[model samples]
Target chain A: MSLKPTPVSRASPNRAGATLDAFLRWREASIIVVAILLTIYFQAVNENFLTSANLETVSQFIAASAIIACGEVMLLICGEIDLSVGQVFALAPFLMHFGTNAGLPIIVAILLALVACGLIGAINGFITVKLRVPSFVTTLGTLYILNGVTLTLSHGSPVETGGSEAMGNFLGASPYAEILWAFAAVAVMHYVLRQTRWGLHTIATGGNLIGAAEAGINVARIKIGNFVLTSVLGGLTGILEAHRIGSIDPLAGGTTVMFLAVAAGVIGGTPLAGGSGTIIGALVGAIVLGVLRDGFTLQGINAYTFDIIIGAAILLAMISNIHLGRLRRGGGR
Target chain B: MASALRADNIVKRFGSVTALDGVSMHVEPGEILGILGDNGAGKSTLMKILTGYQSPTSGTLQVHGQDVVLRSVDHARSLGIECVYQDLALVGGLSVAHNMFLNREKLRRFPPGMLDNGEMRRRARQVLEDIGVNIPSVDLEVERLSGGQRQAIAVARAVSSDARILLLDEPLAAMGAREAALIIDLVLRLKARGNLSIIMIMHNYGQTLDIADRIMLMQRGTVTYEKAAAETSVPELMDIVRREYRAVRSA
Candidate 1:
């Protein structure tokens, strides 16, 4: 489709304001505004919601999820999904913990974790692409294997994730400063997805893998790269959490955060079917959910109720975003 | 001129199904070959094997006098054998410039390992302009573009890759009259470039008659007839298609 849809009702190009207004009414921006307004309103209602301490806590909580979600967004955009993210996330940190405990330097441990996660991603991609297995099922299998590995290694107990004081210093200022890291990470990934050939291919793959391959996109590489991004983010999160909590729990680095990350992505307007959405929207979605969680907790909501609220919010975001996505695709049946 | 591509006795079977059996064809330099067949006539399978999307069980493929194994799509592309599948594979979420140069992005050094976007957008615009693909904006996502525009960009992108042989599978399948005409025009312009050999598989006989120098008919994984474009009529071609399909069904 070569033509950008201009409202046929208006003819004159002389009126810049009308065109600008139409542009501003883009669906992505509208949902983001709604998310922001809800956050601000809740913050107003509960003073604790606006406090530096809670914001710091939420920042740390959302940072890892946000990071993992970036990779998920890229993968999903290509019409593929990485269910192995939660597992790969755990796998990387586990590698670092086991390696670092045995005597490798912290930098080396972190590098190993990053590299291992990347390889795991590559393997997952290879299996999916080569075998022609649906990424969903392949990643799901990897997810189970990873989870089993984490459980077996940790014996269902926390692993001491210690080796580098320098690494600890690099991940935080009580985690809010971690937001700076998250922002920078998001920016870098955003640039990659938007500006680079790899980034374009990832989007293209998500949009139409057939078309992407025809256009010379190494769709498998894009998928592998995305898988690595998702896992690396999760591992980085694990690395950060290990540093933050001063220990790593197998279940603590689990699929719930991965689910939440994806939910935040969908809520932020990244379509589940792929080839749409932005890193910025995902970031905003992460923050919006973080704020919503904080606001509810400050209002003295019960823990179970909070889960119910989050689950509902995730469902709402999925339905609304999906419906809007359909409209954007010219209301497909 | 010598033939640019030759497929000799290509045989591909999927278990009980013989997708392409003893199929053969050749494309001389700068020739436009049209292939016609009904659904499941091995059009895609033969093309797939030729373009390295699939490997034939027994066959010889020669490009520029070298018998090459069509191993992977990337490998095929590297050899300057390009394929445009019927799906018109375009990522709907990307911008026109981005789509026009999806994998082959023009990257400029930003800072050390970083990249420059300003250059990529500029290159995209330049390519689109060169190919005469008119999009309202390079920044607008492809979903916003019309069907014709998308096809134009897809064709333009394929031709831009400096491909010596372009295999287009059903490029006009689902296009309206106006869209189809423009694409046909694009094909003629590409043919005029003189270094490119084109093999287009199409259902629309009229359009194929208009552009192709020669036509080949296949039925049930085998070539049944071949004729120069000027030598065949629509009714004759239709009879050949029907006759081939009947023979295959009875066999």
Candidate 2:
């Protein structure tokens, strides 16, 4: 046999060309462009869309959706979902109420509520992973159970909670507190997803479970960790929403909010099929959702029309992203 | 010279089924040992035992001629034993660099748990280059690569992790002629590079002879015949298999 080097192409010879390819291949780039266009379109349609007072409403929408989407993105990348997260959201404020009534400080009560949410997430993970149930089924079961528990515990009615003004302002009553929390979630979660070993393992676990296991990754730990993360975020969203409204409602952040958070994630390029996702993209996706809702309301479009638009828009964005990805790879299955 | 890996008197049973019975094999340093067998020939079971995916019921394993027991896949890997299964274990959604690093990503010291992706990419490229495997970019996801390229990456990953005893399970099972040639070339290159011992559990007789220095034939959970690849002919191996089939039928 003749000893000769097999001719194989080295890393793309042209640096600039490689950079262009990476930019095109990045799922977030196109989504960002779409988000910007939507924001501009909304600002144009109604001057009130960007007004400080109206912006507060938009920020609230973006904040809640983005925070939940951030958590869901991690779970989605690892091929799990928590339909119960919204229910956890409703249960948290009530948990805090119970804790405060039990003589705990308001901050301690809130922490306790978050911890309870994390435990719920752990249970979700345990049931799904150990019981061999598909996460969709497991979380779906927990969703209704938690909702029922919240309603039963709350006596099927909304109640107001009295906390210090500073605590109220710190939580969500301030004009931009929730949005600030959302940005922090996006920033830190983005780091965890992209820059940490946990994030890489999560992607690998989702991409191929057996392969990840073969590589000695603790697959159960990664999945369970993500579940806890998502649930904690859900509980926090609930607490923030409650404080923002100065009332704890048994029906807060129900299926509607859960679906919106998931929609934000899916729109931001995290396929429900798993394997890959982006926190920053999810944040922008939430912004897109917020702008559409706020913009449509300002234009006197009814809520029903808004739903139709959102559904169609998500489908369109996802379809385009898929096709564009294929095109970027020069086409093929 | 000490064998890179030695499995002595290995036996495995799974609840009333004897998957492997009294199987023994060894590969010397820098040697490619091919285990050719038909389906249910205990090839996979032996490979599993060798890779620590399973422990033999009664056999002992030696790495670098030192007696040791492999507790798990991670244990086997730490002992410089890596298996590239038929599935290749490449996560298609990940970039080439990420798949190469997988569970063993390099982390930044100061940030505490943050990946040093730049360093990883650099090392990934260096390793791939050292192995003489090349592609368009390390940033490209594994799914975009052809089957052969993906296989090459899996092998390169093993090599990068410093695997001394590499097991290739059905490395050529589903590949087309060109892709098979690509892997054959890769195995040959790794052999020429020295210090890495390979045991290929394969099906094709001629391909095995071409790539391996020695061949061991297994049938019904035991090695039926063994010979230097240079001395063995395809007809001779086929004749042995036919004789075994005839004996089984007569029994």
Candidate 3:
């Protein structure tokens, strides 16, 4: 007996410019197009835009945000968000600094710092899942609490992270080192989100919580795991930045970076509503923000105007994402 | 014939209200037991208890004559009991193959937790084909499929999971005639296998008479009638429902 394959009704139209039309139809593909176009436009507009030094600076600026965004993408896909990641990002390095100052081994201090962040994540998960509080409210409260702790510990002052030279070299010897960490995070997380049972479960939990539970999936565990993952990545980003800069600034990585990371994830292709997301899209989103900021600076654009442009760009990307999503669903209105 | 499942004197209470009162039933291997009831007749509650979604407030459940304690949905599934719920419980954004695998995903040999996507897709295709569901692609997200197709996938998921006993809650509700016929055919084919038992909750008495070997009717948390389909008539079932409605109204 011959089994015939059924043809997909909504296959892309076989017409002129089909490749371009297909690219325009997909959210991730369109974002890549915009990123490439922005890069070319910036390079053409400024003589120093494409220089290795400027490119390195751009990468350094994006590295920490990209790492945080990778984690946020997972949390968002799982139907939660962490406003406290920025506070955790700022506080982790301070913990590491104090630990090393107290004669603890550098590696031990880093682990201790990560453990502290993980604890915060667990608290966030506990409140959100077990206590029945919305994650938005729980993370908001933690954000304030963690920020206050960082400020009180540092006396609102910058402190030097007097780590061993070897630790510093391994963590933040060059600007490229931070980029490597970011890419490594992207690769690992991308694989986990796409190729693993945990990843599928996360998507299922976020997609339909009750359905996942009925399917015998431990929804609570998936949510808690994602929260811990997000916090740990934020903590790692903090530790890397402190090692590179050689100092812990209590005000560094404030809520601004948290918002930027979320924006980057959404812009890259992950919906804020949960159920669907991508890590590579988030990486590109960070790069897009980086290119925009670097380009604006090179063009001598005003800082306030840059903020407005970024905000507008985010809104535009979101609208396009929604529209394209509808288009894919048989062009439903 | 050996009984596949037996629920004896099950009682369930939700705080101040009793949802089920001493409900007892048995399903034989290869037999389709049709449960007919009104909106709040405790059919769904009984099904939930049987599938381990909710434990009975008091009672015992037996599988293949062995007394068992159902701790969770997974526990029930381990005992070879599966339920296809009315809500369908499908993740709309996931591909058909992904939904088929859901919590029971197959993993790659080397990487451990990594999903074996190629194998799952192949198996999902084969399963759907065996069930004779005409789906365009297993790669399509379930939300993209028509209503009948969605129902087919949900039923197919339960059928292909090595279930010895299947509980279907309103499996044909809100489906078109063609779609309903398709599900009926699948159910009959599974019955022919002789290794599985089915308990179907239905609102339509005629369809139940067409497919069920035995019919059980419930009204207001109690079993009001039970009879072999061959001996019972639709008029008799309606008379039982009318009498129950009168009793409910008088009380």
Candidate 4:
């Protein structure tokens, strides 16, 4: 006694297309379209937007940001946040600073940085998930502490990693390295969130923790893993920046990256209120932001003006993404 | 087959308020039991206790004729108990196949440590097909599905878990007319699965009578009346509910 949800499955071509269109989710479609449009605009304005040189830069920026944002997206989707990213970004390189000065191999230094950064994430997870502290407050406190540690380690001067050039080149400066890494990040996360049970559990954990627990997900463990991954990604971004700019500074990575990361996430159609978002959409959102910023930069615009523009664009994207009034691209029924 | 689930003399208190006082109920295998109550009748509280969301201060809970203790949701699920919350609790962003396999996803450990999507989609499609759920494609995301389809997917997801006892909280609360009929039919089909037992919490009397094999009327944290569906009419049920389940009218 079951009737088809849709009558006439093989009906008119137009109707079938409409039915399919109904299924393309709004946020994902909009983010991709926005990313593409921004790319086209930048390409038209300046021959630089799509050139191999600028393309490498885009890949590196996305590689760094995507690594951090992917974790944030998972955390946000699971109803958590990490405000300590900038600090984690700064602190990880110091692990290299100390490890190298102490006569360790560059590989050991990088591993130390990853572990130290991961520990910071673990503490955040403990306070927020285990101790029942709000993530907003807990991570904010961690931001200060990590910043302090990095500053204390740096002693208010820049330390250039001249000898560790090989390590830096392998992870940060290698041409097209960012593209491979970005592709790997998106592909793996897409697979995890879509193909693996852990990915589903992560989404469910963020969507409705209570419901997920009832459904048999280890919510605490998932949140902990998300927090740790986010921190590690931020650390890697810091290391990449240190190599690209040729020095490490506690004050260099600004507060703008955090806001930018959060904005890309929401614009990707991942809600601030969590439960459902896609990794591909996240990459699209980041590209949109990067293109917007780079496009304005190529036009000889001031850096600060681009911030105002980005703020406005992000607000608009959020409004459109949040309001589900019309048919949007990348949807499904 | 004595009963799929049985709660005896369940008593729960919430810091000076008695949410469930001497509450007890049973759902025999192959029967659909509808729970009716007015506001503050402790309907939710009783269900929570049975589903292991909350522990009853004083009560004995049994599953499939064995004395059981439910310390957490896993404990309940291991005993074949599953709850379909009013929220439907499905992630809207993920695909139908992804959501269907959520919390019970298959792990693929080949080709350099990544989630295996092909297997996940295959399994999700099989679950949907086994539950008689047909759509344009199982690979489509859940956010695009209609409210009725989402709800059906949820119920199908629940029963697909090898659960013998299903607790559906306000399954028809927000559904429109056409949608409500579809859900009732789905529930009836589930009842025909003899090894399964269901406890449906609803406000719609017509739909309750249409699907439930027995009815339990609850009021002010207590069960006032219990009768087979064949022995009761809407008006007869209404009168007892009006007089005994005063909380509904007052609230």
Interface RMSD, all candidates in order, equals 4.9, 5.3, 4.8, 3.0
Name the docking class for model 1: acceptable
Flag the better candidate by DockQ, 1 or 3.
3
Candidate with the larger DockQ of 1 and 2: 1
True contacts kept of each: 0.59, 0.52, 0.53, 0.41
**Pairwise TM-score winner, candidates 2 and 4:** 2
Candidate 4 ranges with C-alpha deviation above 4 Å: A3-62, A130-134, A173-183, A267-269, A319-325, A329-333, B109-136, B176-178, B205-210, B232-239, B244-251
Estimated TM-score per prediction? 0.87, 0.93, 0.96, 0.85
lDDT of each: 0.77, 0.90, 0.89, 0.78
For model 1, what is the error of residue B80's alpha carbon versus the real structure, in angstroms, after optimal superposition? 3.8
* Best-performing candidate as measured by TM-score: 3
Compose the digit string of candidate 4's lDDT tens values, residues A1-333: 343544322332687676555444344876787788888888988887788888877766666666666778888888899999978888877788788889888778888899988888899998998899999999999888878877887887888865555766766667766556666777877777665566677778877777677676788999898888888878877877777667888786545566667777877877778777778877777888777777787789998898788778878877887665234423324
lDDT of 3 by residue, A1-333 (tens): 122233433444677556656666565886888899999999998989999999999998889889999889999999999999999999999998888888999899999999989999999999999999999999999999999999999999998878678778678757589999999999999999989999999999999989999999999999998999999999999888888898889998978889889988988989999999889999999999999999999999988988998898899889888887777655211
Report the lDDT tens digits of candidate 2 across residue range A214-332. Answer: 88899999999999999999999999999999999999998888899999998888988888889999998998899889889999999999999999979987997788767666632
Best by DockQ: 3
List residue ranges in candidate 3 displaced over 4 A: A1-27, A331-333
Query: What is candidate 4's TM-score against the reference?
Result: 0.85
TM-score of 1: 0.87
Candidate 1: tens digits of C-alpha lDDT, residues A24-68: 446566557766797789878886776777778888877877887
Question: Each predicted complex: what DockQ?
Answer: 0.45, 0.44, 0.53, 0.37
